[model samples]
Target: MTSVQDFATYIAGLPRVLASAAALFRDVEGRVLLVEPNYRDGWALPGGTVESDTGETPRQGARRETAEEIGLDRTLGRLLAVDWIPGTGRPPLVAYLYDGGVLDPGDLAAIRLQETELLSWRLVPREEITDHLPGALGRRVLAALDILTQDTGTAELENGHRVG
Candidate 1:
């Protein structure tokens, strides 16, 4: 274990959790933007798994996922929320949510959905977010929005429930 190679192997063998990052985009009217993924049942924010193996941070992963899923490459805003979700039959997951800011009409018009992954995109008001996102995911998005509406700092969550 004293050798560098031994340390490397030890680190590689350690248990790891899955991580994902997403952007909370909003329209000028304050409607949250959601995307329908072809590979999933419910709608979701524009984001995906962080490429930790490639040295991609959660923030970078959010921006990348936004660009890849919706074709918007703008810089993301401050982190809104972080949620740790317990896995059902797999590794636990750490989900990062970032502020995508309010999109202008032109920005909205410029959206280009990634056909291979996304089915479509739409703007949903806060009240209807649950209808689209559902479950812990919906609650997570709501917590992020609360941070924006209240001007509070970032939120820490466990399974979408605010912890501290």
Candidate 2:
């Protein structure tokens, strides 16, 4: 019979995907809200890694991250997009984007960036999304924008590219 340690090791060896969640908040003028991370060169949506270990759902995680990062407590809407990013000598990741709803002048004044993790927050026009976000993130955001416009369904992407 297999030893207890061996069984545990077998379970541990199974593949796992790191999951992350983010929110897409828009301004009155339809610009997307992007936060500049202190640890990264480009800007990103207002969200963070999902606490799957805590049994948190993607929608809940998105709300939590938005509250933590921007100090804005708001209810998250539907799932905007889901992307499975390929590994680059590292474990692959599954990212979720949720609709955070539009922010008016009052909401805009209430934003308080998480000082430690974020450098600053700004509203970027949709056309300049590529300039703010790098690589897959730019594509992911664009896909999300399209979904919002369609009001149809969620987008499934692989490394930010739409997949069947």
Candidate 3:
């Protein structure tokens, strides 16, 4: 039989993956909102890593990150996509994408970028999303947009390719 200490040790030693949640905001023109992080090469949705250490769930994390990154505290819509990305150097990543709903001109005017982490934000047309986001992330955003357009259920993805 395993001792209590042994069980704790085993749990602590288990491999862990990183998780993040993002909000997908769109303008009335149907363009997607993207932010350019000061520390990254490409633009990203308004969200960040889930504070799992602090016991924050994915939806909560998405809301918090959206408010922090863009100063938009509106209610988020349904889950759009979830992608499991295989690890390259760091641990694997599970990304949750939530709908941020459409923003009117007033809401768009009210956006305040968290300048410390973001350089700028823009609304990219569907065909131009890949130009801003690139790679797997671009694919994920496109898939999420497709889901919204088709009124389909949530998307499950591996490396940003829709699986089921």
Candidate whose lDDT is highest: 3
- Candidate 2: tens digits of C-alpha lDDT, residues 23-47: 9999999999999999978889998
lDDT of each: 0.94, 0.92, 0.95
Across 14-35, the per-residue lDDT of candidate 3 in tens digits comes to 9999999999999999999999
Q: How many angstroms is residue 139 displaced in model 1 relative to the true structure, after the best TM-score fit?
A: 0.6
lDDT of 2: 0.92
Which candidate tops TM-score?
3
How far residue 59's Cα lies from its native spot in candidate 2, in Å, is 1.5
lDDT of 1 by residue, 23-78 (tens): 99999899999998899688889999999999999999999999999999989999
Alpha carbon lDDT at 111, candidate 3: 97
On the 0 to 100 scale, the lDDT of residue 96 in model 3 is 98
lDDT of 1 at 38: 94
RMSD of each: 1.2, 1.8, 1.0
